[model samples]
Target: MKQTIEQLADVELTENMLKIAKRELREDKCSREQSLEQMRNWVLKHEDLRNVRLDDQFLLRFLRCKKFSVPMAQQTLLKYLNVRRTFPHMSTQLDFLDQKLNDIISSGYIFASPNRDKHGRRVVVINAKGFNPKIYNSSDQARAHFLTYECLMEDQATQICGLVHVGDFSGVTTTHVTNWNPTEFARVFKWSEQSLPLRHKEIHLVNVPATLKWLIDFVKGRVSSKIRNRLTLYTQDKELAKHVDPACLPQELGGQMPLKAIVELWKAELLAKRETILNLDKIALLSDRGILRKSNYSSEKSSNGMNFVSQIESIEGSFRKLEFD
Candidate 1:
């Protein structure tokens, strides 16, 4: 059983997981090979996405996240690369061994739970207290987050089951809130919502300081209704556990395993995938030649510029009204 779970990324489909994938993601085993071929052909022909990874495992992540819709997967792939191009500081040349990043991981600021939730989603925790603004800037934090997400997405179980993010803001100070550039924050938020191939099942913010409420509201207003609906706020860990099982959480947040132990395990996982993460630097867009195809996806256009905040706010008001009504 353990070996089977370990081999899932090698396209070893489990009957039970296949059923879930079929029901939830429209993934049909009978047609999966055909679908993969179609996605591969489209990517190969895309003039803009140069040097994109073409392996079945890499392509399957986008396909599964888009529910096997080829066109959606294409758009997502483009957006993902575009994000890397736009935010070179955050995404490119991601070195896990860098002392600053290593220290951040060692502090256990952000990590995915080794255990899956009741609904089979991976639980990712972000303890704001672990961060020291004096030592590292927001870009370092973003890099750490990018590295963690890239590593986690390599898992087939994570790709299919999705992720639940828990933001532990217990010790978050006013300085932490002020450190972020609003435009950069909005752009990153937009990319997470639209570009990333991973499914976001839920986002729970716990022990949030009053200082961050405005920022939370800002995020709620900008994200899609699906994300907004999945967003939940908790005043205490007890309340958070009601939604995310305590068994999946680290000991610091009322779980069984020690936080240090979880961080150590996660560090080892990162080390194992060091080459895979480093290879991300090779994926580049053919933007200089102007051969990149423009996406009709709204977020694709919104991902650029200082005007994102105003643009989202203007659109979100009407979007929310239509969604709520």
Candidate 2:
């Protein structure tokens, strides 16, 4: 930036670097990189994450970001060059790095993901450090013991391609095998070794929450409905409403977290904060759907309640005043 885009490779940033970047642009002479250096300097001076570490995540996010697509800032060009330099396979689709992150988290392991080269000069190296066994514990005690990432394995051999955050862990990664089979492990390894596509498909979208919800809705549709036939989806299970353990509840509600353990942790966090969560259950009845809507219901069953959309018309007062011939 101090010397313009052409100057960056040769000139290290001096105190005057920003002053040079901020100088008025000449017609077609200045580079986008200089503009980006200015932007970066601005963000560093103005953004919250200015002091944050520039680790893999930082660079991954930085190189793929773009606020616009025209007159292509040299920073964008640099980002493109960095992507090719860092993640060659990803350079073309740098715009959708979030989708790529989903695959890294959802799948238990990814193999042969180049992180460093043979000479170890970072031409590329395999990244399998993400396969920590504890991060994906499918047991209730383990999940709510810390309430990190909860993972459960099933018999079916389906592909899992997404990101899973296990919270901030200041501990070493570990691995374990239960009901272990070398053959199964080999198969798991094979799947992990497969070249993966971006975790999400692209459609013009805005807003992070909406984009995530879209992915969730898409996957939820693919989930076998047989597992969800009995209850309304996503509402907390009343049987364990007072208890937050996954082990005691049905499989769908994070069965990896055991009921007893989860309850204890919730109580601990609550007690630490001096908070109380109300229990709305009685001795004899399980929580029923829409039973709470009774107070809002019409006095004479006029069908004016909140769930009017799902209500059926009463046939008792049916009158055939024939609008039809």
Candidate 3:
């Protein structure tokens, strides 16, 4: 019982001594690290004498001299290195990213997820410890910007394959951007229809301006004179049209996106919408309205071919078996 009480007293005295030591460290006029700024200033203050650049050097020596934490050393490098002009090469970008990754891994931090552009190319922006990488909403926009940079800086050839957007391989649908203004969607749909190819007037006529849903009605169709008009007009917004290609916009839009590769696609959509109004007009025609009106043309071609087809088959069989025998 006496030993236990003595141990408790000793622990309390140790705690009090530690607190006094910490208070002295904080209040000491001769304190080595008075604040974060002071430590950083100490490292940066001696800019004249350096064998290696600040970014590439370790601040351990400087830290010991200034008596600062790791953050102070890091702040010195960050303040200086971040201001340098970026190199104009993908290879360099990749190398810088790899160095960042290695630094994090060495520090025992888990690598987060990395975003890949439509071209399957990844450009890592951040490498903080234990953080997952995220592809944000503006990922596509960032991708386009990257492509533009590659074009301007490297003068590199833009491969068509690289242009393939990663996430939305099938066009970016309305569901992708939920915060999209409904009125803007309607207005853009209206514009795409006018700029979209308007081929096969019979079918394209059904693409009305109301309920923008009808724009999708021309997903597949054959190219006609009108298809160009519809797609081109719909994509008439010059900037957007450049990306969508006004030469071959969907019929509902006004231009054919392309007849060679996308023709079958166009045909399928055309057949789908065939029954809307134009085909309805033809299918509902009354036979008596023309054939029974004593027309000379009707008298000459009087065969519904119900049993007439059977008679024709008999004649065809007679000719076939005679040759076989």
What tens digits encode model 1's per-residue C-alpha lDDT throughout 34-125?
67889778878877776778776788788889988877787778778878888889887778899989999999999988877767778999
User: Each candidate: what lDDT?
Assistant: 0.78, 0.25, 0.27
Regarding TM-score, does 1 or 2 come out ahead? 1
| Residue range 139-183, candidate 2, lDDT tens digits | 211212111110111000000111211111111121322212323
Off by over 4 Å in 2: 1-31, 50-64, 67-108, 112-217, 220-325
After the best TM-score superposition of candidate 2, give how far the Cα of residue 228 lies from its true spot, in angstroms.
23
- Sort all candidates by TM-score, best to worst: 1, 2, 3
lDDT of each residue in 104-154, candidate 3, tens digit only: 333322111122233322211111212222322222222222222222111
Candidate 1's clash total is: 0
Q: Candidates 1 and 3: which is better by lDDT?
A: 1
What's the CA error at residue 20 for candidate 3, in Å? 79
Best of the candidates, lDDT: 1
Could you tell me every candidate's TM-score relative to the true structure? 0.86, 0.20, 0.16
RMSD of each: 6.5, 23.8, 34.0
